[model samples]
Target: MDCLPLHTLQTVFGFHAFRPFQEEIINRLMAGDDSFVLMPTGGGKSLCYQIPALHRHGVAIVVSPLISLMKDQVDALRENGVAAAAYNSSLGERDSRQLLARLHAGELDLLYVAPERLMNDSFLERLREIPVALFAIDEAHCVSQWGHDFRPEYVALGRLRGIFPGIPLIALTATADHQTRNDIMERLGLADAQVYITGFDRPNIRYTVMEKRKPFQQLQEFLGTRPDEAGIVYALSRKRVEEVASKLRELGIEAAPYHAGLADRERSRVQEAFLRDDIRVVVATVAFGMGIDKPNVRFVVHYDLPKNIESYYQETGRAGRDGLPAEALLLFGYGDIPISRSLIESGTNPEQVRIELHKLSAMIGFAEAGSCRRGALLGYFGQRLEEPCGNCDLCLDPPDSFDATEEARKALSCVYRVGQRFGAGHVIDVLRGSKNERIRQLGHDRLSTYGIGAHLAAEAWGSIIRQLIHRGYLQQDLANFSVLKLTPSALPLLRGEERLVLAKPRIKVAEAKKEPRRRGTVLNMEYNEDLFQSLRALRKRLADEQNVPPYVIFSDATLAEMAALRPLDSEALLKVNGVGVQKLGRYGAAFLEVIRQD
Candidate 1:
């Protein structure tokens, strides 16, 4: 029993070693102690609990957030020859009854359930009669109001610690900042649990942001570079999702639209098709991608700006899960900011609105950052990167900088002259000397700074003001109609005590001087492209026959390894990273035949 975890790792899950904190986490759970894990997506978070479940007594109860995610996990576990099942709304009456019988009989190793179902009174009573192994909560950030994707149902999960006193419980999430992390601990009553924060850097992903000019054309140009690759295009509205999906189809790309507006059955079909490689792209609102477990996504393009950095980070983290090079492209348009802010302000809870507004401001700062983009992103998570990541747009193609000492003074002065009670629009208007009626009616025309910036265009002035706000020289007072107010740091610049330099605002996408490396290509070793494609086709066929996603049979990363290693016999095939005893018996022969022929 002491050696069972490593034994299970090789014979069942097929991994030779544990990732950073996996073994320690599994040990804590097995010893009947609670834990909190903050690992990135595709960082093998599930295995931390799954391995412990297989080694412990009775069935491990996993509280998942979505039905699709539950099914994907259960499917993959079952493929690995584990007795795992999901009890949810998607299950039929007979199947649900049988699953319950298995639970009562102690015949199952794991059960995935939604938080609502697990919290019901009858379910609580039933669990007391069984020998439960442990309780696991995935996406634990949903329990915190500070978390971007807060769910009211998840708040009730705090009761789990009280309900199951002796059983070990573990909570996991891919995204959380300092505030949200503490909230999750308090809300879930895991204050004494062992906390593991593996880090937030996904080095395989390249982050790029471009000003939104003819966005559809930009998306087309981006998609043109990587053909037949799996990706997701995120939009702000359902209408935009449909529009983008339609346009992509017209261009002969295999694409589909997904949003809350779509029927459940239609959404399920689209999601399944995507997992099976039937759809090359999914144009969706933020509603999609939370439940998707696809590991081969080569890219994720934000058609509109996300409202917050957590949302943006979680969405982008969905790509490059397989440890392959992927791209996260954000089309940042100034127009999207107001739409996002209006939606946030419409919330009835003032506190929640305030939190959301701050998050949005941080997100804007990331987009407007002139230095390292990755550094800015990680800084928000309270982790500092010592150097610029050479993968982001700023690090790759550096932004042009110009001394803006005079421009900064004019912008800060206009904010002061406007009584520090106006938003950026009115400030920019006064700076550019607009003769609009509101400006004249407010009698702001007489101010000395009113026409000081008249030589610059409205866009240039807008850029300067935004940079000042991001640089902490100015702050947006969300409580007071988001008016721009000068910060203490603005005094020195206004008094000619400091010089300022800013990146010339990028209004258009920069053309690459050389052809960039194709995304989703293996970086470590060169694999035979033809053999990789053949192995992929074979995996797809086997997955279709099993009525599961292709990744359930084998991930693209594993296939690439097979293509690279070119193992010709069963003994050598078992040495591949993903090939465990069960997988070796199931897939080794089929893959070997292809490798030998090639």
Candidate 2:
């Protein structure tokens, strides 16, 4: 049993068994084979490599992109009673030399390094002198230029096969489409690797997208409902990050801002504070989230739309990493679309620009979709859900669609009548037959389509315009000041050859429903709130004493299990999902005492 991955899983990681695909991946790796894993964030990708590292004869070399992530994973491994160390820019020369000495001496079971360090000729020469067990490339998607978080250094990983011939190399990532996956395999030279495509659905995270209206206010309302819950607020720019963080703090929330523009030390401090739960929320640009290993992030709020669906999926995947119920809220508007589109269009190559635009278009479709959000999101990744998921906003509150064929025709007529040069506002103005000076100046009031849409309110017209843009019936000339222009698809609709259906717009925020606690929470039982809070207090105190994040001691899920099951002794405590031998030996009594008193 000691040679079994299941044994290592229980004794070291405190789970009863390996998660789906973990055992298979570990088995293959132990047999000195390569693998390509695409499991979701909380799906136990780490254990796939860590177990093999332990079972193998020599130290496992893990190549990662971010220093922060390397440190976080190494710390978690050490906490699990594994000898792990990370070498990165954050370490001083003395510390680097010490860790390298240990690595060479085989005192470290796993050594994490950036791809740059791994690809360094000197570093590779040093590694050649040691007995290397295996090579793991985390965030394998980075090797693919099509992948959202591509790093040029990741392309160097293709050399590992030649450098360490016959050594098993496993590439792992949480997000990759079909094209990106192929690119990753080609780049890593893992064409013969066993490909494990675990389903990409994160059932624990409730997906919700809101129409961005007074975003800060909407964000405030969203955060107000979940008090004391840790979350990440993602903005699109550094200035917005500061503004949102300031606003959140002004509203009495413990928030911090993180971006690349900040000094490295300040960014590190903010990230460390966030990991330790010193901040309740972090307003960050895209720079902050990739390497974060914080498992208790209760929510991830996109204050603006992400660049594409891949970025959205990966960022949202950060939540509920501990297998607890979490939420992902994305607030977007038609305004965010052009900003993202321009960024993509500004790319150098025509083909790359086309690909990016297509990606942005898909993201916009997801945002404006009136169908099951989960289905649309997964569909983009080449996975199909057999039925509507009841976890997302659309499924929970289905919107009503109506035949708007006549409305579509009229809107198209207005766009055409306005010379297809004006934006939605001017078109709407002409449709409403507004006698405003601007319309008079443009002489649009005299047009045949003028006053044709007077039966509908201005806000209604706005929703129709947005839907048209999203539905591809019309394309906004983002390069030319947001002018409304017709795509070829609009031709049929305008000529009455194709009927159109549009969802009735939500005029106000949906009433917040009191959802029953998710079944995954505390093993789906009505646990004692006081007991859960007390357990958290104890965990915080213990974590503070050890100078580790509370989750490094035990996750919210573990404490929830303790609160619900009321484990009275070390034996019972060890049976909890997250309580392993190492943690049970260290903090079992303290947690057992808390449960015993109840």
Q: Which prediction has the highest TM-score against the true structure? A: 1
Query: lDDT per residue, candidate 1, 462-510, as tens digits?
Result: 6777666656677766545668888888899999999988778776546
Colliding pairs, model 1: none
Q: Give the Cα RMSD of candidate 1.
A: 5.4
What lDDT is reached at residue 518 by model 1?
55
Q: List the residue pairs that clash in candidate 2.
A: none
- Candidate 2: regions farther than 4 A off: 401-514, 517-520
Candidate 2 backbone overlaps, count: 0
231-284, model 2: which lDDT tens digit per residue?
Answer: 999998999999999988998999999999999999988998998889999999
Candidate 1 at 164: error in angstroms? Answer: 1.3
